[model samples]
Target: MRNAPTVRFEAITQDNWEDCVKLEVKEEQRKMVAPNWYSIIQAAYDKTYTPLSIYHEDKMVGFFMYGKDPEDGLYWIVRLMIDKRFQGRGYGEAAIRLGLELIKRQEDCSPEIVISYVPDNEAAGKLYERVGFVPTGRIVEGETEARYKVLR
Candidate 1:
């Protein structure tokens, strides 16, 4: 069996923004996360949000945007998605792990890293849980919130 490709995070730049926008989730998961374009749009106006393209070797195959919440100083992984063409290759999980590492590099970042998923996306819940995130029993805007207490 072939092994999964190494995943790396790259800043979304104008030169590659179009590539980021073109990433898409599976049809059945369309409702679970915002479209890639929307994520790019949101990152544009949100000073705290940082959008990143997930690269597997030389190809962009997924997207993730995360940052600190301005309201209360908490960090949040607002969006993460692997394109339909790249799903099931372990990219999403690898991206989140790298995202957490990025968060760790930020000064004054809160110990609790937050993320949310559609209630029905058990796959998302499982993936995050595997990285030490646990549900906080909180729901905002119909999505369930979970926290990863980073030990640093």
Candidate 2:
């Protein structure tokens, strides 16, 4: 079988904002990550949240947002979601890995990148652990905090 197409990231721009907001996680995952619309709104109103549109080839596949907690300088993945139509094809994994790469590129960024997930979201937990994030036994805004090292 031929390998899957590589994933690419495009910074969220007004030109394609509508396409990005249409991306959403599965219905069952509604609680895992906030809706892409919410993220887009946050990105617009929150200076720290930088949203990116994830694409495979030329089609949009997901959405990702991250930024530093300005007060503490802690890196944070504010949102990540594979479009319901694109779920279960490894797009989420590819998108997340790419997101991490972008975070690691930050100048003066924290050594540890942070993300939080609802405790009962096992799928999110597994995906995160599989990608090298480990639970810090910390909670932020009612979600469990997981951390990943980011130097490269």
Candidate 3:
């Protein structure tokens, strides 16, 4: 089998925003994550949030948004989703790892990184756990929260 394409993160820009919005999760997972268009729009109004597109080689395959929460002063990975066509190829994990690197590189980053998903999205829970996240035992807005403690 051929090796999987390299996964990398790119900023959601005006030139690539349309491609980013075109990415979609599987039908069964529609409720598990927000649509890219919604996320892009939200991020546009919130300067703290940075929306990014996940690319496999040169092709856009997913979308995620991360930033520090103004209300709590904590960093959060508020969104993550791989397109239906790219699921199960390890793109999600790679993207998260890269995202963590990006966040950790921030000079003012917090010691913990937070993420949440619909309580029933076992796949998301497993994926986050595999990357060192643990449940924080908090449910906000109907989603279960988990955190990755940033190691020094």
Q: Which one wins by TM-score: 1 or 2?
A: 1
Best by lDDT: 3
Best by TM-score: 3
Which digits, one per residue and each the tens of the lDDT, describe model 2 over residues 22-135?
A: 776777888778888888888789888888899999999888889899887888988878888987788877778888887777777788999899999888888999899999
lDDT of each: 0.89, 0.85, 0.91
The TM-scores of all predictions, comma-separated, are 0.94, 0.91, 0.95
The ten-residue window of minimal lDDT in model 2 covers 1-10
Which digits, one per residue and each the tens of the lDDT, describe model 3 over residues 52-119? 89988789999989999988888999999999998999888888988999999999899999999899
Where is the poorest 10-residue window by lDDT in model 1? 1-10
Please give the lDDT score for candidate 3.
0.91
Clashes of 1: 0
Off by over 4 Å in 3: 1-5
Q: Is candidate 1 or candidate 3 better by TM-score?
A: 3
Q: Write the per-residue lDDT of candidate 1 for residues 9-124, one digit (tens) a residue.
A: 88988899998887888889999999888888888888789888999999999998898988878899999999999888888888899999889888987989999999999999
